[model samples]
Target: MIIDLRSDTVTKPTKGMLDAMMQAKVGDDVFSEDPTVIILEERLANMFGKDRALFFPSGTMANQTAIKLHTNPGEQVICDKYAHIYNYESGGASFNSGVSCRLLDGNQGMFTANQVLEAINPDAFYYSQTSLVEIENTTNKGGGACWNFNEILKIKEVCKSNNLGFHLDGARLWNALVAKNESTKQYGDVFDTISVCLSKGLGCPIGSVLIGDEDIMKNAIRVRKIFGGNMRQVGYLAAAGLYALDNHMERLNDDHTKAKQIGEVLSNLSYIKTVEPVETNIVIFELHEGVNEKEFVQKLQENNILIISMGSNILRMVTHLDYTNTMHEKVLEILTSLKF
Candidate 1:
């Protein structure tokens, strides 16, 4: 059996999700007439207690649009150094928003209120106006690490004092919420804006929703257009998002359980120096000194197991709806049998 653990983005739509998409009542979404898209956006907004939400083609566009909406040219966005906004968004903050980053060396990609306070500019003319603070929940490079809600509230207080806009890259927020047993409204209460992905752990085929006040979302819609994200008849995909929201969210715990199981197996292996905390659905670990990353990955590939080597010694595996209990067992068996 082939096991694909590269990323949660690889999940295929389930039969129920496909049925929803096929039955979707589609209309021109660019004209704001798609019923399914409207339902998905409104449902998510209500879930988070936000005034409004806008759907996008990809998480990158949703996040970049949030940054652009919150900041102006030559402004700064504060975030963890390993954040997806800074590392994976292809420099869209600089290219689209004309802003630079104030990266904090945060613990597992999460910073505290004090960290935000220290990072904000002091209104000096020499500094890039620190207008935005972006955070990624279930921080991708941090093995799906989640932020403490109290820490986030403290950071929100700091942002209020600094007049900084707080944005959440909540691509995996559902996983974080399920793992932490937190309410979605708590997140909505803290962040000025949030970008939630439907395609990741939610198991939708495509789409992301950016939630904020109506005014900010109006700006995001314009930014989405500039980023070439305007769509027509997108309800087919939005139907999938709505269906996933209704059916797939609670099951994310299954993915988290699978990840911890994998981590447990890897922790006992001789070649795995350490496994990062399995807080949610991602498992990241460092290889022992003698094991070459390429060779390790090649060995797994030979066994029909796929994963990504983040660096010379680091490997990453993400579990989602597509990965089953059998797949996890097979991966553990292969890891247990591998020789240094």
Candidate 2:
């Protein structure tokens, strides 16, 4: 049996999800007539207490659009150095928005209010004006660590005092919400713009929702057009998103539990030097000296259990909707029996 743990994005739609897609009532979305797409957008927006939301083809586009909306050209965005907007996204912040980023050094991709205040540039014309602050929940590169909610509130207060726009790259916010026992309204009240992905943990084929005030979302439609994200009759895919929202969220705790199990195994292994705390569904660990990363990955692959090597010594494994309990048992057996 082949087990793929590279990322949750690899999850295939289940039979129920496919059925929903096949039965979706679709219409052209560019002109705002797609019934299913509109329903999905409205459901997510209301869940977060936002006035409106727009669907995008990908989370990157959703995030880049938020960056463009909150800041003018030549201004800077503040975020953790490990943010997906800064590291991933193909440099879209500068390429699409003509804006720069002021990265902060935070614990596991989460920074404090003081860090935000310190990162903000002065009113002087010499530095890039800091107009926006972006935060990622269940920070991906930080081993899916959830931010402390109190720190989020403090950062929001700082943004309010600084008059800076606050945005959330909430691609995995559902995991954070479940792991942290936080409410959607709490996030809705803090952020000016929020991007939530349907394709990752939610198990949809493709889609991300950007939420904000009606006026902000109105402008987002034009931005989506510019980004080549405008689609017609894509409600077939939106139907899968709607279905996932109804069925897939609660099961995320299972993924989280399995990830912690894998993390515990790694922590006890002789070849592992350190394991990043597994807060949700992602497990990342560092190999001890004298262990070849490529060879280690190949060993697992040869065992029919696939994972990802983040660097020469770092490995990443993501638990997802499709990773069954039987596969989990197989992985546990393989790890326990293997000798490095």
What would the TM-scores of all predictions be?
0.99, 0.99
Residue by residue across 117-218, what tens digits does model 1's lDDT show? Answer: 988887889988999999999999999999999899899999898788999999999999999999999999889899999999998878899999887777
Candidate 2 steric clashes: 0
Q: What is the Cα-based TM-score of model 1?
A: 0.99
- The prediction achieving the highest lDDT against the true structure is 2
Error of 1 at 98 (Å): 0.8
- The residue ranges of model 1 lying beyond 4 angstroms of the native Cα positions read none
lDDT of 2 by residue, 1-340 (tens): 7999999999999999999999999998988899999999999899999999999999999999999899899999999999999998899999999999999999989999999998989999898888999999989999999999999999999999999999999999999999988889999998999999999999999999999987667789889899999999999999999999999999999999999999999898888899999999999999987888898899999998889988869999999999999999999888877777
In model 2, what are the clashing residue pairs, if there are any? none
